[model samples]
Target: MGPRFQNNDRARLYREIYEQHGPIAPVVLPGDVPCWLVLGYRELHQITSDPVLFSRDSQLWNRWPEIPADWPLLPMVGKQPSILYTVGERHQRRAALISDALAAVDPFELRSHSERFADRLIDELCGRGSGDLISEYAKVLPALVLAQLYGFSDEAGARLVPSINALVDGGPDALAGRDTVKSAMSTLLASRRAAPAAGVASRLLYHDYARDFSFEEILEDMMVNIVAGHQPTADWIGNSLRLMLTDDRFAASLSGGRHSVAEAMNEVLWEDTPTQNIAGRWTTRDTQLAGRHIAAGDLLMLSFAAANGDPQVRPDRGSFTGGNSAFLSFGHGEHRCPYPAQDIAEGIARTGIEVLLDRLPDVDLAVSPQALVWRPSPFLRGLASLPVRFTPTPKSTAGGSR
Candidate 1:
């Protein structure tokens, strides 16, 4: 099996593959799923920037006949019929609608809500003196922010995290998770259609594209947005917290030395990309990329993690200041994530992490950082848990006592 599916030391494995196999290396994931990992900075730029040769729609795959019906990678690579999976004019239309709905959210309110959610989480955990920072804190914060964006109450946000985790996890239980998410989303879609509340979902309903959507379409779109919105932000917060607790040089920057929260977030984005590998491209015909032969219909994923660590990428760059495009964490080309608004992933991630660190200044990993476990998913990267400890403090008044 390729190093992609291995739960431990994934960044080192990708670098090893790059040294052995050059820019574009072929690797087999679990279930014997075969695909190419684009491992170089230059190679990824070319593939992502050029869409005609690499179709985002897996429906264009000529190799599906060879793939197993129970293919475990469906949740990642299979066609989900959303803006995320489409290309050209079809992608533009739906992407615009999602962007418009996202823009409707007030940025000040979004920032305020994220800070409030982060502060509230600290309030619950600060008295404990110890907790699994992953499940108890970082992982749950973004879902709460997303809950507000979707027009659902903040309490309802916690309920959707499990389903999102299931959808991304390449385990046997994932299908059941997908089903639960579908059922819940369908109910949400129905409620929005009937009552029309004031949130992203309600805004989406009135859009020309969604106005004619069937129940299944509405469910699929909603599911895609929730996963797209929450997963990376959670991963960002989780990865950042792990680095702050484990790496001294990195942690120093966060503790009032060099980097701001935005700088630290960009550093993590460039160094240890949250969404490690994403497979959307299907080779339309035989083509050679960066000296490697890519056959028609072969699946291809951009190794965002590997590309960031590529020799050409400046390992020291900490901020997205100026015009630097050194990271491909959010991807490139027309298919770049549509919801770039403040109330979306990045805003929630920055606001939440900054508040948590300020309120819990003494937080440190309870377990050896090396002892932490990772979920065994080939397409994504995150810790299984981050056990941490700090001196218990009374409820924080500085965080507005939220």
Candidate 2:
């Protein structure tokens, strides 16, 4: 029997699945379709790295072509070549170039931008005394960061963030959000192509992969970076902050010098990563992995959340390190996330948390931790709204400027 992934009680659900399913186990998802969920840290590591046996090209997925129009799984599994769907040479070439483009980003500049944006946002909220951190701060801040990376105007971030959020929700909103993203990306990239800017998107358009990528291809890549980076970054920010507030030991670890902010971020990435599962890895042929039987064209998913929490993984950050380390929150091999490295992303989040803690000395959850609601989704783990109460303070003279 397969495990039902309960939205509200994810920790318990993941533990039960691991205890029962071993590392690689069979399960039927919400759509009544069967799939193998890779649960163990070592098991997922092997599968995610083995490209010959497990293909990412969704065209190999048997049920996708005729999936019901109303299927909830579409948002997570739908074909998008920008990063998640490509396999083999395509995946390798595209990922390398995107990585190179992101490598050019100045970490100091990114951190400064995040801090300035945080201060500006807090300036607007300090007088109010309370606000929904998820909507007001966490979500918008990441999108704005992404907007800067893509060289998008301030106006574009406002439009893209909500549309991207809606896009991930699936169904009718997904369609609208998809169009909104496509329109925004197309306009943004088209301008870059016409008169290139000194940024990630413009650099990508001139990279090696762009030789084979059409205008549509370039746009898809742009959309994936902005969409991928923002949501998970937002989730990371929210989840990490939640840990600081709810887990007294964790909070103590951060405040009492047991763990630095960087170490705390690593702990969150291992313990409660924003991305719970990455779907749509199809088996190339009948095979057995980690002593499990599989058939050709069988669907598989990597349970990063489950694996990081596996008994095998050490929870301690060990000297506050980051990088490709043992944590699979960023996935591994050919299909990893194509954005800034762990250190850069963490730098942005660090600045954000630092600003919030500095500006609002006593900010805290507005409700009990257990009462917090996680949105129902197959791929993402996010709080629906993070209502936070803070001491009222005078707004900065900076006003509401970006």
Candidate 3:
């Protein structure tokens, strides 16, 4: 067999490919899955937004044994004919229901909850002086929020983060281990059957849509919310912290300036979005993308990092300031990330980081920069551990009594 799926330096690889091949290149995955990687801004939009030529449904590759029948995995969760994977009319309806939940949530209430969670997490993290920011703070905050938003209990929320992490960090072994995670998810779903939280799951479980969705379908949808929304959301916060701490100018813009923390995050996200690559499809019969022919059935891989940094679309921008349009860190078109309204996800993230900055504004790295380990995952873009010593700030009354 060819070498096992080794973790390649994707940052360097992305830059080189874009420079050399000019965005779209035919490459074979280890499993011999042939697809084209789209590295330019325009092509990514064309391929991801298209539903006809490209399919989000894993069922398209059902005959390909190397790819699981669950090939599309978490993205395919909550799949009614109306689910995201479903096309045309069905896709639209399911997307609408999901969108309604996002629209229905009170931004103020969401921000408040996010702030409280961040404060609690920071308090715990501050005590350490140094810890794996990802595990200690970053992972818990967003996962818990997503869990609450998706109608799981506080206890269930606490546990679900690990289950979600296992899937992302554990690779093929963990993907194959979904049965274990599914068991816990089932109990939570069933409990919600009786005592559902007032959130997305409850809305979908009892909505007019409920008539068609089975328990498994609902559980799958819950999985999507947990994995897609929570993991990356939290990762971005942790990653942003690392960036601010390392890059002096970027760091100063956050710590010393009048720039809104949201603007700082937009800069970090422009410089570094969590999603490195995404696999997607074309909607029409055939198309030319980045000067390459794309037939229906051709899969498209989008490099968010490359596109975000593309010299053409990305303006000659400096540090994020007000009245600026940053890169598409949340994505573009119909499937853009629906969080951070007036800073929703960033509201949560900034709450935590602001507290950290205030507490230890002039912290120093505990170890050499090169010694820090980056999270070894393809999708997530962040460090695994961020060790820094800082001068702790005075405890705030809003921060719950320790």
Highest lDDT: give the candidate number. Answer: 2
Q: Kindly give the stretch of ten consecutive residues in candidate 2 with the minimal lDDT sum.
A: 315-324
Residue 234 shift from truth in candidate 1, angstroms: 1.2
The C-alpha RMSD in Å for every predicted model, in order, reads 3.1, 3.4, 4.3
Local error of candidate 3 at residue 316 (angstroms): 5.4
Q: For each candidate, what is the lDDT?
A: 0.75, 0.76, 0.63
Once fitted onto the true fold, the runs of candidate 3 whose alpha carbons sit more than 4 angstroms away are 1-12, 61-84, 171-181, 195-197, 252-260, 282-286, 315-323, 339-343, 392-402
Candidate with best TM-score: 2
By summed lDDT, the worst window of 10 consecutive residues in model 3 runs over: 1-10
A best-first ranking of the candidates according to their lDDT comes to: 2, 1, 3
Q: What digit string (tens of lDDT, one per residue) describes model 2 on residues 163-207?
A: 887776564687888898889888878899899997788988998
TM-score of each: 0.89, 0.90, 0.82
For candidate 1, give the lDDT of residue 306. 86
Q: Please write out the lDDT profile of model 3 over residues 1-402, one tens digit for every residue.
A: 111111225545666777888878787654466777777877777656665556676455422445644444333221333244656666555566666665666766666667666676667756556656678778788877766666666777776667677776656656644565677777766876788677766676666666566777667755655566766777678777776767665566445553555565766676667777765553344667778887655556667777776656754535343445556667765556554322456666776677556556676677776676766554567667777776655445674322
